[model samples]
Target: MAELARIQPSLWFDSDAREAMEYYVSVFPNSHIGSITEYPADSDEKHLSGMAGKILNGQFTLNGVDFVCIDGGPYFTFTEAISFVVLAKDQAELDDYWAKLSHVPEAEQCGWCKDRFGLSWQIIPENMGDLTRTPEQLQVVLGQKKIVIAELEAAGAGI
Candidate 1:
């Protein structure tokens, strides 16, 4: 076994950790599912009765970033406070991710969107800083649900 990542984001799910992990791996390149530990069937804990056979801990990599997830009962959920940022190389990549991940239209704002599983993601260009260097360019980005690299560049250049 390889050494564990220094910092891995752990996600808690009601009972869909495996599904979520698989979906993520399919969406990203260089990604794969790792070891999955299921809850013991003979556990004495009544509280975990429904969790038997479910994923107690599942590891996966999304574009090389390590993440762990569990099928723990729904005591919590994802929120906008914490979101994954995808620095896309260009508009095509950004649009591809946005098309696949953006499920909640109400949550869309400034390149941030919520996936079907309620996970928030910021799909922005790799050169976002350079594109939004000017106030007009920043405003252009802020007003758009998905970031348009060309628009930002035009705004930055006063076009």
Candidate 2:
């Protein structure tokens, strides 16, 4: 099998590649927008009118993880199948991420939320694996939208 270049995730946007990159960089620590490629005004691409001077591609780093966003227009959209998991160190971190990342209230489930750009994310606790060592603990995790560390601990302890 061919090797992957660190498996950077690329997000497709209708015309908000730069916006998405900036938003992500603002939300995550140690993140930055690397480079941006704009579509040429004279390009013969199919969607010339909307593509001209738009961000064709944008490179960004979120919490040190590299990602890309493409302003490919409305041909494609994001789904829940693929998502980024923010492993928070504590409830405070999780709450911060949850506030910044959660935009679609209906999409909030089991610590997963869809942002304004329709991208799904899992803002989970770092100690989740250690706590969810049993079926009950796992159920506790599945029962809520935001993962509360205290609740997980309580459930794990059969409290």
Please report the candidate that would top lDDT against the real structure.
1
Q: Show how many residue pairs clash in every candidate, following the order shown.
A: 0, 0
lDDT of 1 at 101: 93
Per-candidate TM-scores read 0.93, 0.91
- Give stretches of model 2 more than 4 Å off: 1-4, 42-45
For model 1, the stretches where C-alpha displacement exceeds 4 angstroms are 1-5, 42-44
lDDT of each: 0.91, 0.88
Assess candidate 1 and give its lDDT: 0.91
Model 2, C-alpha of 2: deviation from truth (Å): 11
Cα lDDT of model 1 by residue, 42-76, tens digit: 57687787678899989999998999999988799
